[model samples]
Target chain A: MSDPGKSSIPFISLITLFPALLLGTIFGIPHLIGEGSAEDLITLSGIGVTVTVTDLLFVIGLLLSASIMAVVYYVLVSKYKVAVLADSKTEELLKSRDFFLRLFDDSPVPYLMVAKDGEIVLPNKASQRLFQMTAEELMQYKFHELHDDAYFAQSRTIYDKFVRGVASSDVEFEVVRKDGVRRWVRLSALPYRKQGGKGKGGTISLLDITEQKAIDKVKTEFVSLASHQLRTPLSAMKWYGEMVLQGKEPLSEKQRRYVQKIYKGNQRMIELVDLLLSASRLEMGSFHIEITSFDPILIVKDIFEEVTKSIKDKRLHIIENYEGDHTNFFSDKKLVHMILQNLITNAVKYTNDDGTVRVSLTFSPDDLHVEVEDNGLGIPPEQQDKIFSKMFRADNARLKVADGNGLGLYIIKEAVESLGGEVGFTSELNRGTIFTVTIPNATEGSGTKSN
Target chain B: MVLQDTVLVIDDDNELRGVLQEALSDAGFEVLTAENGSVGLTVALESKPNLILLDLVMPVMDGWEFLERLHADAWGKGARVIILTNADDIDSLSRAIEGHGYEYLVKTDWKIDEVVDKIRGELGVQ
Candidate 1:
């Protein structure tokens, strides 16, 4: 077989020129060797002179036909090789493309390819279902378009942080669906990278967490209602028990002792119920706060006066260090009172007969700080974390007092947090405990403060 | 003090009321007992007892309603009504005392002697 590209032109030229050569020979040979006898020609040119013009032409024609056949064979072989290579390459490409496309389409989690500019470029079926939008509709929208204005801003900020490599974990945000219903979605994003490390765009995976939030809300409501219901009956029992113990009755010593036991038992039950209710409410986040602006100094004075009636023998030293007359801050008055009352009560209860409990109220421009320092059996370092937990009485406190339900500090912490405040304490066992409460100024509105 | 006047003990709990009646009878005053607020209000009006013990939670009419009726009725207006029940809270106790101007006592808290003393005190008996 001859090479088609190389042999075709040469073969055609040789075939055409061979014909002209044969014709030229046919016309010119007669003049050169004019009608002569074979013997006479043989004498002139020996045995070679016996050849004819027709035989020479036939030889030339046979050579031309072989050349043409070689050119056709080369063309057929080249075409077959090209067709085989093309078929194999196309098959390989189709298989790999189908595999990759199926993997992307069948992903369980909602996956979205978003441009760096926040536009939705490619969204899989799961993504479309998650956003409650059709594929064509999703392509026309952006990530921020899927949520309300406030949530959009928050989501954009989160995405920007993610793109900047500042966010380590997935972010949770509220997003609106096509039906305009809000939902919670957890998003994890990865930056799109090209071969040369250039940022092309990013991809985000979304997971819905709305059901968990609803369960949490319902639990909170249940705890709040139960607490209120329990308080009413407990209040009734406590009041009646007090009246019985204070009644004037001439009775035998045994009867008096029995009555005293019953009164004490009922008192303990009332305390346990109140603590349980508070703890449940705190756990459920059902406590309500009524924020009002009042002088912290005035609150301290009132709490001190109220606590003093219960602490007959204990000495309470209250120090007020406000720079101006209006040492006021916004807070729930009742909650603040309860917080101070709890701290002061604990101070007096833990202190010895004449031990000192000093309460300080300091005011700054941004915050109001209240400190209750008591020189009593201080809590151990190991038990500090458990002190604020419901029904968690420290071992040292248990030795000092046996009647506490271990809910005072827990309730105080919850109340403080509900009022957008912070509470902490420093203690050295056997030395003293200093509890510090820092509440923001009246300017901060009553909202849930996350730590 | 001889039995110069009768006391009406009105309470839902029969045993507790019986104990009060026995104790009050022993304390030199004749005592009458009623199971509910309506019966107690009736006895208070008919017997014209020197003192009345009222129960708060009752079947037909509650102590609140009985107190309202007693305040409006002609016969019960003068009777010294004291609340003797288990509903014992500052709010309820204060409402009973301040709202109705009646001394409130808890049944579980008060002993027989203490109840008698309260009755005698209200009766102006020495």
Candidate 2:
């Protein structure tokens, strides 16, 4: 491609004329040699015409100079047009660049461009406002500098990955401002390389999410409070039922049955409230972990005793299986109990009369495995994916039992997750469900206790 | 006359207190009732019941303050107190209760008979 701005048209035209001048001199020299003398009159003939050398030469020179000027004129005009087009293109590019720069500077979301080494390169106006510092002041700091020490270590890892040309999106981080106030932000970054893939850099954007976090906390607290408030009335009803049943005078059979129904209804309501409370506590991450060595067999036996009435009501055969040593087990006792209780309850509730429930405990050096298999109404295949979701109940399970609140499985999943464990289930339609849970033993260095 | 172990029931709910009183009296223990934590603390100091069924949330004084005040007295250090709460596993309270190895029960989860049995167990009334 020719650079119209760089090579001048006049210079090119002048060079073209030099070759023509040499040809003209060669033709004139031949005519002068054939004429009478070199200094005398010279005659030239060409193209079936005769003329004196001076007149011919003069006509040729005039024609050559005129055509050269025409060529030069055309070249100059085109070059002028090319130059004008190039100028406008450059101006448009510059305008758009300025517009985008302004947009980046004025955006409410904080924006930052960092170098390959995670050093802050260019911080936009919003970024400066977020940090309450000037771009110049922030330029010397790294991307993770604004985070607290614990978060700083984590942020450094993410920043290092970004510097290695990895992209990250919407990772939540808590950052401290210049005034020592902490706020939550979701940060995203995309890696960019220089032309020819030389140097690596990235653009980062942070969205302030402190308000959203606060609203979430408030919602969790409300759920907790509402559940507690519901429990008081339910408790009163339960005790009242107990008192009437335990009264001195024996009541009629119908009256006793009605009282029992009231008692059971209150009991169901109380269990629902408890599930809601547990779900909310799990959501809020407020539950504590107490690590103690206990026997899994003992826990299972105790749970069986707790549900002995239900077991007898259905005449369901209860089977216990202990695999391996079944001792030296350590985990969060409450969470383990919660997981097992929910599983066993579901097994008892959904199993048909005379159905069998197998409670299996497998112990290893590193983990404990619990399996509760019941010949009960299993979950529908299509809805199995949502079994562990909050407030999700299978179609068959819902039709079978009208009293379940659908939070038992969700609580189990959440509790197991918090204990750094895994839970899964296999079910066949109308046959049964076997829920299997594996919880890792709390090792010496790594316990499930998180405050 | 057979010697009966005295049990104090401290709660803000009148109906709950009455029912618990009846149930504990039927369970063969001398039952004392208080409407709130302050009253319960005074009754506990004066009567020195063998066991105390204390509710955590109440007007005038909560169960935590009552526990604190009760523990400040010399005789109260070894007093057996069973925390009965409608709320589920409050973080700080549960931690403190667990630290002290005190028995904690959710009121709704327990039946009257079960509570009586637990009180019997605590007082070694078998």
Candidate 3:
């Protein structure tokens, strides 16, 4: 098949006029030699016809020159158009480059382009504002110089790893301002490489998180103080009530009933105090896990027995599959107990009259999984996100029981997580909810799982 | 000469201390009570009870200080110390148990009778 472009337009091929000239010379020279050159003087014939050779030669030369000039004009104009197009493209690229440079300079976040050598390369106007120094002054110093001296060792190690293709570029760092005040900054970097795959420079954006850090510190302190102070007195209340209820003094029937009410009310107060303490410990990140090796199934059974009265009051059916040898995990007993208590209570409280509540324990070499599933008033899909949130109760749940502090799931989630386990639930409205907690069994070199 | 198993209750709460003293005495153990860690340490060293149920949060000297002082004395070493704490975190729990070789229990979680029972169990007494 012939090339499609080969037979297309010969007009643009006029730029190859050297070939055109070659053909013109080869063919014209032959024609001139064969036809002979028209030359000289005028001759008069008897019939009165006269002609000059110079006139005919001048006419022939004019036609040949016109043909060559047309091809030359086409070639010159096409080349000129190509040059203009290239120039326009260069101009567009320059405009875009300027726009992006201004955007970087004007961003609220401080931006700095850093070299693999830890040198501060290209710093924007915002970087100057953040560091309280001019670009010229900051440029001479290394990137880690802006960070607090305490961060030097770690920053150096991180930088070394980053360039060595081992570490992530995003990290939180502390920087001392020009005024000698420490500021928290979240530094995220975009690292790139050279064309040859060698590590190149990266750009970092610093977001000042000083205010956020301060707020977090205050929140932690408040939680720590409140939990300790509030629960101390409740312990006193609990013991005194239990003392009177179990005292050997003979009391009338009415008096005994009154004392029992007091004990129950005191018990409720203690439960509330415990809920608050759990919330505080979880929020302050001080919820301690003292893992002791114990049979998980035993703890589950004990929690079920503790909540038996509640189960009977609600008339809920109790289903237990706790048989055989479950795992003896090295885990925090108190935390696991709290988790089981919370989950079982939730199952009992949310379930309807005569609703089925099942407690199942399954074990493996690597992990132990405990699931508390109930055919309760299952949670709504929209409100599921708020289930683990503190003091959050579903609308249906609130209507059924008004006494719930709604900290049950929150405590369960925090306690289970403190044990280095995961807690998740599956629910359908008016059907049931199943909460599964999976904790890794520490049977190897590790002693106990604690947080 | 073997004697009756003696138990000491060191706690800040006047009511809880009184109640535990009454309960343990009823359980046929010689019950001794101290209001704070300062008096408790002295009493513990003097009486050398078989078991001591010490509450962690107390005035003057806390349970931790009492244990430190008790460990220093030769007589206090013979008694088995059990810290009954209201401190919620596990660090305090483990510190009370590991630091002094004491048994730890949460105050509200245990009934007054249960605390007495635990003391009796630790002492191998009725």
Candidate 4:
């Protein structure tokens, strides 16, 4: 026997080589038989030789088929790997697409994607609901489809500006819905561009502001109507009151007292009406202020002179404390008058007989601060906030005073704010209230002036 | 203060005008009345009244129009018009006195004697 390693190698090779060996044996046997055998083989060639040749051909064919199978296996495995990679890439793309779609769908504000030519490309669910249109229908339509012709034209202008990159933020507009419902919407848009500036598109967001617009409209109408109605009656009251007060007719003591009562009542009504009108104007941003450079001290002195008689009984003490060389500042003189009048009048109204009311004016380089301090029933903390509200009165003041309509402080606050000034107060129950007003100089046009 | 000096009351309210006439008569003055601004203007120009009580807010012609027309007329030059109006604001008062050249008196403050005294003052009666 050969060496152990060599013998083991042959055995292993034979196990793998059985088909090749069998094929070789069948074919080589005919050739090895020689001449006699060859003659016999020739005679039996049709059968034996054919069998040998067939066996050889089959062996060779099997070897060739194995080689072909190896090639096919390599090609199929590589193809499978490529297909798997392609599938995973497709799956990743689909996941990203779905994520963006979900984000667009879930956005709170109504969103619409429009092509460059104003065709609707996509609309979020909110957009569909707002316009009361189905997704399919909205995609087939444009923004003009839901608005009136006039508004549609306006929308085109705004959209054109957005396309040209001239406008960057949302613009407010009125648009009509498919159901003929008009609404106010704040529309914001972004220009969408594809790779290399090839494709252009726009995404628009619409915020419904109908409720706010309605509230403003109602406020304007109410102010107009109230002013007209209140002024008409106030005119009659003032005219008649003055006529009676002028002593045009002979009167007894009782008659004079009655006339005086009526006059006083009418005068109070006029004041109330004036305060109401002023407050309404303030809230509506229509209150007029004529800003000019004037001395705050002079204005305070003038106001004091005008209201001195009313507060004479209260022993009111008004002190002017102005800074040096800065007495002159820019401000609306009339508004200043009204502010001082309201504060001083309020002080007199709330102060007891013989109580003291002090008016002090303080100024700085950037601002003018006026403080009106009164020793009266101090405001309760709970009622402080409501004091600046129109037609609101403190409970204690309401119980004690007959002349106030709760509009004095409200008007004061409005007038102050309109002039770019601030009004605030400090009070302790049963102590006293001190109102402070800080206003910018007149050069800033803090007050509105009526033509 | 007598029949020679007639006081003209121009107002839109017929009831008010009638009451005014009666009150003026009792207060010892001859009174003439017109319901609208146009007719009141005609009456003022024709009668050459000692004093004219003009009411604003009339139907055909308002007090403003009447004042414009009356001020333009030669006969109405010397006539004193005490404006009977319901306007209370300083702007309206200023317009009446300065812009329209008239004295404004509110209706609610009206008294018979007061009206007569104003008329007497305008007429220069002692």
Candidate 5:
């Protein structure tokens, strides 16, 4: 705490010297003139007083001393200004430090400051509350050590990355609090460096996702329940319907027609249930992607064969234009099936009598490209934006078909996106619509087997 | 004259079991039926059926446990199974394929004739 104004001492001493010099010049000059006749030196009479050399020297020293005093005063005032500035700056720095500390302490999100070695340097109030421990107890453990044993390996990997100055976001972990309660947390970390300090640390933020994870688990369980419960009865109906159609008793024409209708209606009900299950799984993010090798053309052929009745009824022209020999491509079969099935079904259903529907498959090392084109009722421009929405049908489409659930395109979009692909379309009202799908090939070792 | 291959149809639903029994009988096999996995396993072990059409979800000792118990027996280790269930669960599908080297079919996705064809192909029967 040395004085900030201490540098003004030399200026003060110089100012004091001016008065002494004035006196010395006043008294010493007369002696130097020698006691004979002081009038011999240049003298001026002004204001009826004799102006001697000593008087002239004395006036000059007085003026010099006044200038010195003025210089000293300026230096002192400037020094005071500097001190005031330094004070405000220190106060501003302190206020900012307090603001951030308060934010870290009072924030709803749990935060922990970790040393470079992964030790818990500081745990805020929220983190202490989350772990159900005091700050002192938390400080005794490393950040990753607070996690459950089952997640310890994964947690260590993330912490290792963090210690290497790599930032990570939303890595999930399971942790047990001191009260023996399990919690799921998604943590994000960033490297932190202290101002004018040598050590580098990390600032980790945690979000308690236990409740959200529970909700997701429940949703997934519901999907599974719906799949089992709904499909079991549907299967029973289908088998019974098939048995009646294949019974040994001879049937009248009317009876045959009615049985066929029952069979067909049961089949449609099964499809709707399947569609609803797929949509639910897609929305719940509970669907798994299983990659396998298969002939995409065969898939196309199977779909075509399945819809042959409708194709025949409409007298639609079918064209298969496969560009490359990708008989055994690797990708998620379920997603591919969903994408192609929806597009081909829509094309078939919307196309009119004598209309043309073309299925094309182009394969490359990086992408599998599929296009289904139908020269039939194109989507109206007004409803094009909502084409991929769930249970949405175009006005023309609804008018053309009496029975349409409209979940096809929604499932297609969701499945395609999950597979890291894109589905797009081009259509003109009453002219045509072409739906295109481009999916990336699965990387090697991801697929389970070949068929 | 050759002996007709025997097939076991194990399912929880009674109507489904009856329908499958009739269909498989018509398809020229000695069909045996059980309403759940436990009874089906006992029948399979006793009769040594040529093939088993197993349903995943059942009342007593589900298909997974049945498979495990069957594989532990000497005569049941090589038993052929076609998983016939309406559930399209991927985890169970992969487990059945990779663990037991069995085939999986979503019942709703396949017609009875198609399922019969798969069974015939598995049995090498016309």
Candidate 6:
């Protein structure tokens, strides 16, 4: 309150000093009683006291001196108060700055403050630990020095993007530490403005995710090896089992049944392995979507020939409807075939004898929709929600069919979704289920997965 | 009469090789087996079989290498190759086909009797 221009105490002091001057009038009171004249008040300073108790000149001089002292006291007090206030304000600002600095230093996530010139402006405690160096030593090297040479350009681009607030949400890359070890780190960055400079910088935080990446890699490798190695033996068993049934001399009814059972068992194994392959690919997120233009009708015809005899023997009617047989779909042909195969296989497997399976395909400018409707034992209402869940089987589905592992719908769902499509169904118990999948036409547009 | 024609089975799986040899022989075609691609190539050159069933992914010379070597040989050029392989790598399979169109079969997808029938068809027999 005590900047000379800003202090309110000067006005209050002026008022208090004005009232003290009233004592000067008391000096005149003696004169007013006819003891002396007001003009004689100044003569007191020129001579010694004249022995009167109410000398006008003496009283006027005392009152004026006291008023001067009061003004001086008020100004000094206000100045002291202002100094105290400024001291505490500065202290509070310093404390908050210290708090943020400590937080950055103590954070477990490694942080690097990088200048636009690519120099390491500051390194936190975690960064020091990550790079196997002291903070001072870390700052001695540039940002790219802590990273592999292969990652320098990428790191620079990411830094620029981050400073501009345009980088991807999650950025992950590998870096070489000072200890000569490489590790993967997920990075997040924030822009930092220099206090009094035209330069801008970024503070990047790194979280080590090497262990998670390693685990994922091992899982993918194991799946690949199992699929590759298991197929050979399974192939042998299937071939031999089939050979026995196709022998020149026809076996008895009992022997034929046993051989047929073997063949069927092998087929189930193949189906399971293929399902595993798709599941692993989905989980690994490495399923490549190769969009090739092909006539889907030919695929349907092949599948039809494979299932025709069995459908006929069971007295079931199979119908294939195409609005335009010549209409070609631009999509991942293998995945589309898989989607069709799974839905149709489920239809054939779950339906009762003499049931009907109708497959109709509709075309749009942007997508193709295939609907597989079967009057099979449909899923109950409560179980419909979980039909696409892994290893989920309907109670009635299991009762009607005993050999299902419940991966068919899951694989179908994965394959369709990976192709940027949607698969959904509506079903009623003992009536029918209709599965319709809409896949975007890669012909008219671009998708995430194109080889 | 079918046994008059010889077939070479190039595969590393001993048990599968045994079963396939027995099946091919039962179908009346004489069968020769080798455990790896290199051994199979030597046997194939010496025997000069009527047909070759090449298995990919064998050690000491994979099916691709065997085919390359077979193409270089004068006697081997006339032999029809039927790739009986467990390798499911799509690019490799397609690339193998682009050079010389061979009827490739995924072993798991075909039965032994079916393999016999496919071989018979290639040989122009019933």
Give each model a TM-score.
0.47, 0.73, 0.69, 0.52, 0.64, 0.62
lDDT of 3 by residue, A205-319 (tens): 7888889878976876776666666555666766666666677777799988997887788788778877877776776667655556789777877887888898888788888
How high is the TM-score of chain B in model 5?
Answer: 0.94
In model 2, what is the error at residue A39, expressed in angstroms? 23
Q: Go through the candidates in order and give each one's C-alpha lDDT.
A: 0.69, 0.84, 0.76, 0.72, 0.84, 0.79
The runs of at least 3 residues in candidate 1 whose Cα sits more than 4 Å from the true structure, single-residue gaps closed, are A1-174, A184-209, A251-291, A305-327, A343-358, A374-414, A424-434, A443-451, B1-126
True contacts kept of each: 0.00, 0.65, 0.65, 0.06, 0.50, 0.71
Instruction: Predict model 2's lDDT versus the native.
Output: 0.84
lDDT of 1: 0.69
Check candidate 3 and list the clashing pairs. Answer: none
Q: What's the distance in Å from true for residue A356, model 5?
A: 12
> How far does residue A34 in candidate 5 sit from its true spot (Å)?
6.2
| Per-residue accuracy of model 5 over A1-451 as CA lDDT, tens digit each | 2455766756685865668486756666665767525563553446556655565666777777777777777878788788878888888999999999999999989999988877888899999989999999999988888888988778888787777777788888788899989899998878665564434788888889999989976876686577678887777778767777777778899998998998888888888888888887777666787787877888899999989999999999999998875965888888898889989998999898999999999998788999999998998999999999988999988888988899999999999988889999999998999999998887566755322
Which candidate has the highest DockQ of all? 6
Kindly list the per-residue Cα lDDT of model 6 for residues B61-86, writing each as its tens digit. Answer: 88888888888998877778999887
User: Against the true structure, what is model 3's DockQ?
Assistant: 0.51
Candidate 1, pairs of clashing residues: A244-B109
lDDT string, candidate 4, A1-451, tens digits: 1223323433444444555656666666655664224233323455554333444455785686556556655655666566667778888999999999999988878888887765788999888878888888888876545555657666777667555643336576777776878778888777666554533668878888889878976886686567546555554454445555563587788977887888777666666656666666666655556677788787667767867886786666656566654555888777787888888778877877777787777777678888888888998888887888777888988888866787788878778877778999999877789999998886654554652
Docking class of 5: medium
TM-score of 1: 0.47
User: Alpha-carbon error at A193 in model 4, in Å?
Assistant: 30
Better of 3 and 4 by TM-score: 3
Worst 10 residues of 1 chain A by lDDT: A35-44
Candidate 2 or 3, higher TM-score? 2
Ranking by TM-score: 2, 3, 5, 6, 4, 1
